[model samples]
Target chain A: MKQEFNITVFSENHIGLLARITIVFTRRKINIESLTVSESAISGVYKFTIVIKTTEDQVKKVVSQIEKIVDVLKAFYHTNQELIYQEIALYKVPTDALYDSDQIENIVRNSGARILEITREFTVIEKTGHKEETQALFEQLNQFKVMQFIRSGRVALTRDPIERLSEFLKERDAFLNSMD
Target chain B: MNKEPMKVTGSEAVILSLLEEGVEIIFGYPGGAIMPIYDALYDYDKKITHILTRHEQGAAHAAEGYAKITGKAGVCFATSGPGATNLITGIADAMIDSIPMVCITGQVASPLLGTDAFQESDVLGISMPVTKWNYQITTPEEIPDAIAQAFFIAQSGRPGPVLLDITKDAQFGELEFSYKKCKKIRSYVPETPVDPFKVKAAAELIDNAKKPMLLFGQGVIISKAEEELKAFIEKTGIPAAWTLLGLSALPTEHPLNVGMLGMHGNYGPNVKTNEADLIIAVGMRFDDRVTGKVSAYARDAKIVHLDIDHAEINKIIKADVAVLGDAKKSLKMLTDNCKKNEHKKWLSEFNKAYDTEFEKVIDKDLHPTKEGLTMGEVISKVSEATNHEAILVTDVGQHQMVAARYFKFKHSRSLVTSGGLGTMGYGLPASMGAQLAAPDRTVVAVIGDGGFQMTIQELGTIAQNKLPVKIVLLNNNFLGMVRQWQQLFFEKRYSFTELINPDFLMITKGFGINGQKVTSRENLDAAVKEMMDHDGPYLLEVVVEKEDNVFPMVPSGASVSHILLEP
Candidate 1:
């Protein structure tokens, strides 16, 4: 069964790392739904949050393969239930649509979106939610005369009761110390 | 770290680091981007020798051949841009086959990076997918550690090629260099520790198995665990079959050794894979060629996979018991735990299939009555001339399958050819590395006329080096393998598989190499002998029947047991 898996990879801030990681997916013909890279809690290391729809077997294999890369410290995959995730999207609509005021205001308020800026030419709205939810806001705004819109790739945090990176570091330190 | 309190150029550091790693010779070509390193190399003439290959691709393949033959990491160098891109194929070849190679390509000056300067390309970007790990050195200081890391990564853990793209400025810059041999990486685990529990479980399965068989690959040789595998098999008295890379690990004539596996493999091994009660796969990826119709492969068997790479486990065939570790250690543990026993019934089944294949396929091919000189007879003749001891480096096609099926191995690492990638032009250049690494060994490169033409320019490297490598050309005027498939499945439509012609003997002579062409079966044996007897490189072209096809093939997508002996 194909289920959406959110895979988080932690690695060094190395050059060509993104292209390298994506090749693994491209090799397997697995489509990435969303991807975002950002600085992690660890100093000098970065995190890659990637979303893909695949079987549990495939996702496990992909994670293992990704971790095989030299710079990658670790990689893990989780179901949607295991991650607290959100996608942020911004919509730009002509100010003329906001001129009506009542309908646009009601839609914005009902959809839990924020008005980032309003100008004589256009109004910009922001929404932070699940991909489908943010996409719903774009759809509602699309009914109006929307100028342009864009959605940021997914950002995620695992809903882990135990801290993984700390434990991993502790284990790493013990292993290294033993070598001396 | 080196205790010398002196400064050195980055190019000198590169040479020093390679020397520290015990690299004696490198296969490479000098160009604009790498001239600094070549300059340093010019002074260190006593320390290291570099063979200037005609093409970067040839250098890369030669390095792979060297590594494969010597069981050491092969080194090669090239300038960036076209030189680096030229290496991409060989890099991919090494990656897929688990050949250990350290490739250093010189890049444009650091400032010129990403600016589309002359001979500048994103080599780090290009080589990443093909290499086990790759790094760029923009400054002289980083060269030592990066190179140390590159060597470490290339030779350790499921070995493959690693690339270091050093900028020209870095090579020219001066730095107070100190060399630290990287013994360990914090994140990299060279050896995946063998699980005692899994080893115990695996031994129990081997003990309980009634019709157990040991299937081993090049991993046994890679881990230098040949003795461990032999002990395990001898103690267990199990029938063993080999993957292409695994050919020379165990003596082919060993009593319990079965035969090859995959397409164009023997009939018995393929049939018995389904019959065996336990399938113990060690050090081989279950590639599609090996596991034809995986659904039917070893269906009745409880599969036990012992491999160093964890990712390989259950990637294709699901293992009921997975013993993950270095082959030497894991096989040792398993050997210590296994009991002495024999699967006589299983052994007999393999022999039965072998006898049938020998009669139907082996006999006629090796001893032919057809007017034209057959490829099989030629390889068989070469095997005889070399006393089955020569390193048989073969290019891809019907000749490759024929060589694997017919040419025997008398020692470990006797066969050096592209197995996983099946790269066509691998044989001729690879022989250069194999011969350079083991100058005492007689290297015979058996290539098809078609594949030989692909990288035929490598003749320059061989002649320039004055290396003695016997080149056997099976001249059939078509790409035999694809033509066979077309003939069988596509109704005898040869298509564009036919080649016009080439006076190979003249071409080889032009390169100042001894050469001959044998048309009759009577002259075949003497021609092979002459090629082997030559003091330097020799090319012997034996014109064979054009439409001849290799059989005992499991048609694509079919079960291995359902092998077609003849079309």
Candidate 2:
């Protein structure tokens, strides 16, 4: 089935290298939902996470092509079901409605929200949860006047228990030594 | 045997001349080709503080921040090709904001210039549109004069970015270095004042019109004529509205100052701009955001444009009387010649509209019992705590609008945000640069959680330098601006508007910077005070209402007259 897949790649940083990665998806007609760059544990390395909707074969080919890039060291592909991810949404509703109804409060508690501020006319709220849960909350809250909204691209780590970078690096070095 | 004067490269002459100009700081990095200039830098007196940035882009931004805060030409240097190209965004950022800065880049040797030499890029050609002036120095003798002229152009007129590209060979070759006082520049003649006849015509229009509105732009602030603008508006009792770049030109609390007048502007400002019979626009280009669907904007109004740049006059919107001159000089002349008329009825209507709209968004009693804080409340508390005096720099997003809407900046260049470029990751780096320039002044980077994370790598730069810049992370956990679009235009399909962030507190703590999370308004004051009290760099992760939106929005593709205040 065609589904959305968020692929997070860990690699070294190079100039204009993201363009190369995105071009692969673009040429394949894969629409990227969101993309972000961050630093990784190893010095001089960067992590890129991109959300795209495509089939398994297409993702595999894309990952293989990405791995072939000079600076890309590792590519991790995670389907929506396999990985746990959270997103944030910000909304600005009318301030006058704050005291009139508890509707806003009910929405907050159900969404696992934390109230960030209170002013005379408006309130600012923050919520973090799974993508579906966050979207559900936005849908529920959209009836109120909205001023602006934005999301940080998803950042993820493996949920399963695994050795960290230090141990992984050591093991990889030992394997290379054995091969030598 | 006869002795002669010692010789030095053109690049060396430029450096020596810059030092003579009393430039105490040069933010840059070293690379191939420009090694000669770096060599010369060692022989000079240690008055100039050379900061080695991780990237050339950072150098340019730092220079921009320095210039913004100090009101002087900030200098940055880069080597050819990639380095020059990297500086392009920062150059463009400064250009859009009308900042005074001079960027010097090393080009590949003149002979190998067009041969696609290893690091050679046609930087001057690429930077022409984004710079006030740009030149590639081919000869050794032109270095001193070019350097002098670059500073002059950058600091004078409307104040924009300038670039000087010198060939690598020029840096290696030797020449006698001398400084000559600049008599005058012929090609670059900035407007002095508007024609007195045109000023009289503008005054007559203002006097005769029943509904007169003033549209101010960044030119007023750059010209240091805020007082003159206030006088003109106050004397005429004319209502005024601001553009994004015009935010610093008028005080937020001024009786006639109707905040920003554009797509995301205050309702009253946009309404008045639409309803006015006469509009006196000064120092601002009618940016598309300000005049959405231009055919409908101020269609019935008589438009008078006063700008220092002749090219900007009638560039986008036609002007009834185009007065090409310094904004200050032109406004002063207009005020001097015009008779004072109090538009009491018009002012009352504008005031009523302002209050009605202000009450909706700026009510202090409204409490967000919801999951997140509202963007309005975040800005309200930020301005309240800082008294709106801190150097408030913001990355592009919903947060930029919130700050512009709420923050009351009293000084010129007080509020710095990406206006024309709207670049993300601009806030943190630009704030870092600002704090470096104004070390003692309180500087804050107000960025959305999404925008904050974009350039958070700059935290390393902040931590490394120990610069005390307060960062307010409005953590809504969503790409708040895009989500607004998804809600309004995309029908809440919400394809991917989420961000799961690492615990910001832990993240800040790992960097050894002070970090605090304010979950409620009760905690906000304390957290801000604690962060301010702790000293060094501080990150205040303000978890605001996720669903909160900026109000009085002119719906996308709509005219300034059509605004959506609420659902």
Candidate 3:
């Protein structure tokens, strides 16, 4: 019953909000495989895209609980099929290893990666793909003594373009205006 | 910009907001950081009654008792550092038990927040893990909104404790105060309206089931849905059981109201849970105490969990039909669609275990057998003395379980005890709150000697206020519950459970309250009567059997059916 889930959370940026949000997941003993927070299209609202391996039931409850936090505007869980997602990974290898090597270029081309820079000490290659693909490219280049490697957490866009949180805010503003 | 509102100091805002919220009483202790609010309180003396408890913990428990009994948010006040830390236990207790409390803790000036200022601590940070929600107010402007939000969060959904930590500067600062009650939040929605289809489906399931049972919890009283629940039980003729907090929800005398269901619960309900075809749980979470060993607990029963919190729906036992909404509305909906059917066979099965339990445990316990001043006998005596109408606030331990088992209630909200938290020192101060909340009723605090000493300082609060709360310290000279566990499981290695005593009567006398000690069972009835009768706060310590254990107990982590009928 355990499958990959992408939990998307929209919230107002507040001090200690991230700590509070992480505490929720920590208390539930749910591991966050990858988590990324960034400014959303709506001004002042931030979006957190978290990848968690859990059951659908667990994901639903977690989303509902996350939504309970005062700063969280809305939270939702989605399967990979419902989200267009990708992670960008950067690989740094010794420049000497790539010296006059057509093999390094062939590996980069096959993995859909491109060299961003070639310094005196290292060459940096950036790859944009699913997690498995990035890991695969890293394994293929391991023989060249990669100096450093880093991968960004998943950044996702939902299948539907219509934003639910905006609608909610519109309704809330109407209510507040009516009260005035 | 909007028109500026009339100006008031932060302390004034707090006072006005409390008045607006209809808070009649508060339990608290004064200190330097909270002086401004206390001073403001003095000016508005006519609007509120604040009982200065001996300790912050007592104040917290007292607030809990008030909230539980009155179905409103109980308020408490504390100063910075040690004062707020002392309230930690009570706050955690309130949180776990779903008791609504708005705890206001005063902090040092905002500028000195992170600095180690005099009597300064990060109370908001310390209380976050334990509280349902918390807010820190830096100015008077935040007082109205913060307090409103605190109350709303504390009382809504699965009600729990919420703390407001206000800096000292805020209490002294002035701001334009226009108080607006928080009816809704941008994100925090407490009530998720029930689905009619889900309710109908649950009703249909109930209508079709042969052996239907209802397990009610504190949510009934919390939601004020006792009548709706009663109608549901009467309509379907299903035998209903109670979680500890659910004890007084259905009158003990009701035919369908079977008995308690937990580790120290009755035998009938525990055993019958496994055999029931349909288990309709309302308002109560499937706590581990209620469902002994999760794997073996009601495995055959098709569960229909109706609760306000959606997260609790399938957290434990998977609900075959989940009806998520307020219990009042959900019960009404379920009741409207169900067909009336008499489950005589199912009812008789419960009777069989009752017969077994009565002969094996209840009969011997309630009626004494030379075990001097048996706990059950003392409770029976108290029940008789008060005509079964008193508000019983019991502390946790053997005494609490014994009092809960024997004390008969005529109405709901009559028994207030720490169920989920199981806090040991809750009785005395809670009794004060109970008496204050229901001024006419006799509030008896049945506590163990160990638990009694924990908050015995509250006797000062009682004496000062002249609140007529009867204190029954069941002096076993041991942490009796843990001792029972030690005896039963740890090869009778009663390590460190025994207590060196002080005379409770003398202690009570020191607090300027009447006191009595009864060792002989002969004086038990008279002593209980005297305490209940002449009590403008009286302490009666009854020395009971030290080695006796509460029976019909399902050993921890075992199935309900594995309950021990006798030692």
Candidate 4:
């Protein structure tokens, strides 16, 4: 069955590593739904969170290939049930609309969103939730006319208590030490 | 740790780094961007030998050939822009075939990068997908470590090509240079630890099978585990077959060796692959060509795949038991765990199939009574004359298949051809590197008319070096492989597959190399003998039948068992 998969990759922070990781997806014609990169908890190591709608088999192969990159320390894939993920979206609306209706404030409250700032020209509202939830908030605000909207790529963490990369590194270090 | 770094120009540091890596020969073409490196090279004539190829592509292929023959990472040099772009094909070719090569291309000055300066190109971006690893050095201090990493990565694990793009400024700048060979990288693990449990499981599966088949490829040669493989085959007495890249890993006459496997491979291997109870694949990925239709390929068999690359496992044909590690260690472990079993009944079945193929196809191809010369007979003749010991480097085409099928190899690493990429012009330049690497051995390049013209300019390199490379040109006046496909599948449209005229002998003479042309069967033997007897490089063009087809073929999208003996 085809469903959403969250692929997590840990690597050394190197130039062009993002392109290298993305090309693996491009070659296989797999469209990435969302991608996020940031420093991991470990010093000097980077983390990549990529979301794609693909079969389990395809995702397995993709993760294997991603791990094949020289700089990639390790890669793993998980289902929605296995990960805690969210996307932050921002909405800009005309400030006149906010004053014209109390419904806009009600809609914002119901969507669990907060207004960041308000100027005479526009009002900026920020929301952090699942993609569908953010889209729902945008639709409700679209009634009063949303001037602009933007959403960040998915940021996710596995439900597992320990960081998989650290475990992998420890095992690898042990092996290397044994070799010595 | 106590050694002090000596101040030297980056170009000199580059040369020193290569020397530290024990690189003795470099194939390259000089240009403005790389002039500094070449200038530094001028003073080190006694320390390092550089061969100036006519084109950057030829240099890369020569490096590939050198690497294949010497079992070391071959080094190549080229300038930026077009020079770097030209090496792309060879780099891609080496990448696909897992040939270890370190290609150093010169870029414009650091400030001129991305400004579209003269001879400036995004070599790192262009070569990213193809190279095993690539880095750009804008500072002189980064040269040594970058070059060291490039060589280490290129030759480690599943070997592939690596590119290092150094800016002109870096080459001109001076730095305190001290070489430290890279012993390890925190992120990369070149060797996968072999699991004893998996090896035991694989051995159990192998011992339990009634009909077991061993399929090997270049991994045997790359791992230098030919003896281990032989022991494994001998202990189990399994009917072993080889992929094209795996051709010379085992001697052709090895009794347990069945034959080649794939589209135009031997009948026994193709048919019996479907009938086998277990398939032991070592260091060879199940390429589409080898596995006809994957859904039906070895459907009844349990596969045990042993490879260094984990990505290759379950990529095509899924293995029931996956043994991850170098084939050398894994094979030895499996052999130790495996029991002695002579599957005499299974052995007879392969022989029966071979006899049928020999009577039906091999006889006619090897000893044809037809009016024109067959590619098979010419290859057979060459094999017989060379005593099956010469290193055969072939270009891609019908000629490649013919050479792979008909040529006999008595030693490992005797065949160097572009197997995965099927690069057309690989033969000529590769032969030069092969000869230089193994100067005592005869390096014969078997090239088709279509492929020969692709890299014909390489004749200048052979002429300049006076490298004793025997060239055999099989001129059929057509791209025989595609023409055969057209005849069988496309209703004989021809479609620009036919070539006009080229006086090959004249071209060779113009390049100052010995040449001959034989159009008749009566003159074939003498022409070959004369070409082989010549002092240096020789081109012997043999005009064969225009429309000859390679048979025992598995048609596109068909099962391996559905292979046909004739068109």
Model 2, runs deviating above 4 Å: A1-180, B1-6, B43-45, B181-183, B364-371
DockQ of candidate 4 relative to the true structure: 0.81
lDDT of 4 by residue, B1-567 (tens): 224799999999999999999999999999989999999999999999899999999999999999999889999999999999999999999999999999999999999988989888899999999988999999999999998898889998999999999999999999999988886787888888899999999999999999999999998899999999999999999989999999999999999989999999999999999999999999999988899999999989999999999999999999999999999999999999999989888899989999899888889888889989988889998888899999999999999999999999899999999999999999999998898899999999999999999999999999999999999999999999999999999999999999996899999999999888888888988888887788999998999998989989999999999999988
Cα-based lDDT for every prediction: 0.90, 0.78, 0.89, 0.93
lDDT of 2 by residue, B316-365 (tens): 78789988888878899999988888898988887787787767655631
lDDT of 3 by residue, A1-180 (tens): 999999999998876677777877889898989999999989898999999999998888888778777678788889999989999999999888888687898999888899999999999999999999999999988889888999999998888878777887787667555645
The candidate scoring highest on lDDT is 4
Alpha-carbon RMSD, each predicted model: 1.8, 25.6, 2.8, 1.0
What is the alpha-carbon RMSD of candidate 1 to the true structure?
Answer: 1.8
True contacts kept of 4: 0.66
Model 4 error, position B565 (Å): 0.2
Q: TM-score (0 to 1) for chain A, all models?
A: 0.96, 0.86, 0.94, 0.97
Error of 4 at B343 (Å): 1.5
Show where candidate 3 strays beyond 4 Å. A1-3, A54-57, A79-82, A91-110, A114-125, A136-148, A160-180, B1-4
Off by over 4 Å in 4: B1-3
User: CA lDDT of A168 in candidate 1?
Assistant: 84
Clashing pairs in 1: none
- What clash pairs does model 4 have? none
Off by over 4 Å in 1: A93-108, A117-123, A176-180
lDDT of 3 by residue, B320-429 (tens): 99998899999999999999888998898898889999999999998767756689998888987888888899999999898888898888999889998899899888
lDDT of 2 at B185: 49
For B1-567, candidate 1 gives per-residue lDDT tens digits of 666746999999999889988999999988899999999999988989899999999999999999999888999999988998999899999999999999999999988888999989989888888999999999999998998898888999899999999999999999887888887777677666799999999999999999998889999889988888888999998999999888888877888889899898888888888888999999998888988998988999998999988889999999999999899999999999988888887798889888898898888898887787788999988988988888989999999999998898778888898999989899999999999999999999999988999899999999999999999999998999989999999998989899987899899899999999998988877777778778899999989998898978989999988988999
Candidate 2 chain B: 10-residue stretch with minimal lDDT: B183-192
